[model samples]
Target: MPDKITIGGVSVDTRHWIGGQRVASAETFSDSSPIDGGTLGEIARGGPAEADAAVAAARDAFPAWAATPRAERARILHAIADGVEKRIEDLAIVETTDNGALLRSHRRGVMPRVAHNFRFFADWLLSLEHEDFDTRGHRNHVSWDPAGPCVLITPWNAPLMLATWKVAPALAAGNTVVLKPAEWSPLTASLLADIAAAAGLPAGVLNVVQGYGAEIGDALTSHPDVRRISFTGSVPTAKHIAASAAANLTPLSLELGGKSPLLVFADADLDLAVDLAVEQYDNAGQVCLAATRILVEDTIAEEFTRRFVDKATTLRQGDPRDEATDIGPNIHARQLEKIDGFVQRALEAGARAVTGGHRGDGQYYAPTLLTDVAQDSEIVQEEVFGPVLTLQTFTTEDEAVALANGTRFGLAATLATGDPERAERVTARLVAGTVWVNCFFVRDLQAPFGGSRLSGVGREGGTWSFDFYCDLKNTVTAPNGFTDHG
Candidate 1:
């Protein structure tokens, strides 16, 4: 890697994108890369005033943006996709450098999806069917219209992708957005503003504000002008947003964290199960939907634990830039210490580490597994958000289901079993937004993504997202031949 990552042969923007321009402020914060603890750049410090300006701009632009023809909106989204495709490498580098995600994974796995999100929503918009019904006494037409100015707050991990997941559909539905990216991972989001502008996104249609949440989160989420708020982060933060949004009776879509379970049945393919478990270490297990809980059938638990521990020990941890590196450092020193705390506490509580345990050098924690953990313990019930996996055994499928749903979160769950009938049955019983049968983290763009209970309030992707971003209205008309005979 070089001294600094650049985009378009220039130093990347680290300021807020508000009112169709990059706004720099004297008050700023240092953005550091997790790779080597180097300062990446300084980002603008935005507070209530900045958020107000962005919301005002979006509110001003909403009428015209909302009225823009579906075809025209689709065309602009396609252009944005094209712009992203052309600069895939530049954007990918920014994401990896700022967020410490693996460059190899992002370039190949995430960049394409960035463009695809726009395309997917754009196409979905054009193909949507406006409901029209003809009856003997009256005619009725139901249509979806933009919900007006909205707030989109994204988290640090997978900032670009998660923001895109909300922004694409919101824009496609013609809702102007004031996006506040997590302060730690603001570079790539800043680049997206340039891409959108280059693609002809009208001024004030998409605004980005970067700062600490405490500085701007309340003002953004509670603003009367913002009709909707979509957030992806911790459950505690979501609750705060919920209370603030309620001040305006604003609709909110919250995708919170999870302690998701990956069930390994007695009849599961052991090799495949091991492979999936290892893959969960991607992003150092910072992902909200990762399989943090490894619940295996009692009959096969011992064998599975041995294989899993051996495989985890082999995973290389180093600088993410290295193609051979399997696990990168946590986002920051604080996260590393947090992971260490969880592991230490579990060990002290009598849970045994199967293989790798303890924190390594410089924000790196070895992939850890803890067996003999109680079902109700903090290690098993809480979201560690690290590469630490808690192992638990279940004697029956009922027990597996109970253990999986024991946590406050119900974001997602995965099960590996040979019997299709049993898979579907268990899937139905699990109270989660998404369920995977014999697979891990498999997503379909058209399928709804979210959680039940505290995982999230509303679904995203496909029609569900469109519904959230748009307000539905029904128009009732008099019969064709009937005039207004007041």
Candidate 2:
């Protein structure tokens, strides 16, 4: 491999990292930047052969790495965190250029959080307490065992942060990793692999295989040696992976799509509600946890609509590298077309676009809010995953709960109200795995995080993350007085 390759006017090193070395693929795919639809460069396109090699490398290194002391593993993790912080500016630029998210958001939030994911998991590993029980003069000790090779399939929207969300836990639990990054946002994962190796991570402990998910995902998921799988994507993709892993009985932790709701009560703080409403336009409305379905109490619906439309229309959309840009272009032309289709169909069906409704220059899409929408319109019920919000008015608490829980998805929901009793009441009735009252995306690393219904399969955070990454084994010691001889 060359010392560096030119990508969109920047010299960067992005290649498949296998067995602690950079390996190029026989075939390549063009990765286009959404900023101007310019060709970034030809990315390494891995197939079954590359997938097999990565799995082999991870398998070969698992035994020694798993047996390594936890303290040493944690030290290396902190070192990785250090490397991430040192290169925060570089990673933020690459990620913004690769995925079209605002560079300011990445530098201020995403990159810093990426470092936090590593350091938090590392410290948590050290502070963990194993379960110990003594019953009837017998001792029962529960321990965590590394589950061998793991396959981590991450999404494109927030590439490095989400990949490390799984990578950090899997490595801390002593499992070797084979990461399959989204084709659209593959750059930062390669950077992470380099960071890990520089942090004294042993060879083959972490490998990256990049390509289209359709070709490479099957081989990685179906591989017999892979003991664990953690995926974050659409529900249909999760079902396909489940079938592939079923033969090997490989456990999976799937974090799927969402059509989350944000219920605005009549008594809610109007400014707070409108601010939260405008935040859906952040990242071009690509976040899965975004509450795109807005269920508002009819009493304050008129004033709420006016404030929401004003703020959303003013959101800046331009070059992601600009600090002033609040919203960036959609990830690609394909995504932009999809966002348009959803908004257009809704308008044609008598729904009114309160703010934005058309595609802007190039891949940029105008932030949109739709009112007078049918409760069961395809746009209302489906996951558009774009900068479009649907409005529905309800008068009663029961109607709000029903409207929020009416969809098939239950990933997350938001409630804005001052009454603590009502917040608790509505929160209890919302079926989403995570319910945010008076805020959005406020997270604690230790909290149980995942989706309900079609949103996802298993919880991942705190011990839940370790539970998926490691095998829990319970040891029971027999009482000395009643030891039986076989």
Candidate 3:
């Protein structure tokens, strides 16, 4: 392996960006591409000291940034959008190499979407309706101000996009930020620091700390200067962060893990349902909102299973760089093992793999379909987080809804029904943050996105994001009655 990996025509020896400088640490760790197991490069391993420096930088910059006019903040955000758009291709390549998501999705879907997020949030601020009212002869003025220094911890699944999801709104609301990208995928986040700086974000206003969550995350969340924390990762880790935030009584927004379900009714269009299945398994099924649990009505279960397995068999698992590839490798060796273990356990418990079920070389797993699986089986109950699907049959509408909401997660779900009334009725009963009636994975920039139960704690995107990243202060004024009192 080379001493340094070149991405986007630049050599990488990863370092944290603190106070607008690329700062190195005494300790560092190797970062490799999950695609081919090739070494990407070495990245600084930040400890508490580094975290402290990042928090301190954000703290120093917060007041000035907060005091910046909202219109100016919106302008900078638009500049950020332009910067992101300018480097979209390069950013997409870096993200794909680091995270093993399909290059096409990263380039054509995620990167552009991230740029759009900045634009969306920027326009939202410009079009905002500031609230003011009068009651009891007193005028109350409500306005939003930056929520001070905030720490954003994003997952590796879709590093640039997910990080932007938090960063855009936070910056748009005039908050200084310290970002901790997942160790597994830190390249793009590092690149983002450069983009933001070039877009004219002030020094110490935005910083990127690249390191493992355990060492640096604790310090950032527990830092007294950090007023708010927004994290996207596993439920267990979110819980730990929540605990840490409690020490300072800091506010938090967590978008945790998900084991979402997709239900197919007997009256649904089978072809469309199959298409939805394919969409759910997109991104190698690593998406937190992917449909892992498929509940098909008993009457049509047999045909649905056959068609689903047929479609699953045809999915292409190959080099992520290949635009034609449908499934990419797992993010790491450990993740590959976890996905394999879950499928193996289900097989041991009498689940049948009608099509692809086994692991391939170098962290690649075949798109799998497991039928005849018990609802209580680990494969159905837990998140496999690979291109694997488990099928179960339900005899009644209530039963289908029950199976869909059976998991501890409530991130997202999809229900397919020909009858519009049935679709509405079932959607109302499904316990998820977002429910699609006849489609899967449809998203809107204006819609609020988050989860229920263990999935997440707060909503993001649209106005919800603005609310979370800023503090709404209400001021009241009234006429004095001093003359009458005297």
Lowest summed lDDT over 10 consecutive residues: which window, candidate 2?
A: 1-10
Best model per TM-score: 2
Considering TM-score, which of the candidate structures 1 and 2 is the better prediction for this target?
A: 2
- TM-score, candidate number 1: 0.96
Residue range 23-115, candidate 1, lDDT tens digits: 876588878888878887667888989989999999999999999999999999999999999988888877888888888988898989999
Cα TM-score per model: 0.96, 0.97, 0.96
- lDDT for 44 in candidate 2 is 85
- The local distance difference test score of model 3 is 0.87
List lDDT for all candidates, in order: 0.88, 0.91, 0.87
Cα lDDT, model 3, residue 1: 31
Using lDDT as the yardstick, the better of models 1 and 2 is 2
Where is model 1 more than 4 Å wrong at Cα?
A: 1-10, 134-136, 481-486
Q: Indicate the residue-level lDDT of 239 in model 1.
A: 91
Model 3 lDDT per residue over 359-397, tens place: 888989888888898777788878778888888889998
